[model samples]
Target: MQGGTTIVLPEHRGHRLGLALKVAHHQALLARFPDVEWIATATADVNAHMNAVNDRLGIRVVERCIELTRPVGRAS
Candidate 1:
């Protein structure tokens, strides 16, 4: 299963809510799907807190993806 964006309000930071949320979701996923063996999630490289949460949950980085964008214009 792949996780989507998870956020805790700025006023609610530093309470380990992110970690708790991930843990709860993982437990629920396993409970609902005993045959499932893997879960995937991604966070921006700058997001240290989320990275820490994933690390604590034993989620290792297996791949890296980079996004690139360019403005479109009339062809010359």
Candidate 2:
């Protein structure tokens, strides 16, 4: 359900391995928790590669969010 800092191994490239892993994990979760109503995930807006995978997996983007940051001495 997440991919923060983990690096994919070189041999796994082009196999859609990430997508396969995510689908399998989600299926397992659903099987274990039948009451669950939703599955959610995110990728950076600029990551066309992941977006393509999401599309193939039928994940609809319901909404988007942005992060804001400020320096320690700066006022919001």
Give TM-scores for every candidate, taking all chains together and pairing residue i with residue i. 0.84, 0.72
Question: Tens digit of lDDT per residue, candidate 2, span 1-76?
Answer: 3434323477876788867776777788788888988777877899876788788888898999997887675553
C-alpha lDDT values of all predictions: 0.87, 0.74
How good is model 1 by TM-score? 0.84
- Model 1 Cα lDDT, one tens digit per residue, 1-76: 5666878899999899988888888888899899997888888888999999989999999999998877778742
Predicted model with the maximum lDDT: 1
Candidate 2 matches the true fold with a TM-score of: 0.72
Range of the 10 consecutive residues with the lowest summed lDDT in candidate 1:
67-76
In model 1, which regions exceed 4 Å deviation?
71-76
> Candidate 2: where are CA atoms >4 Å away?
1-7, 71-76
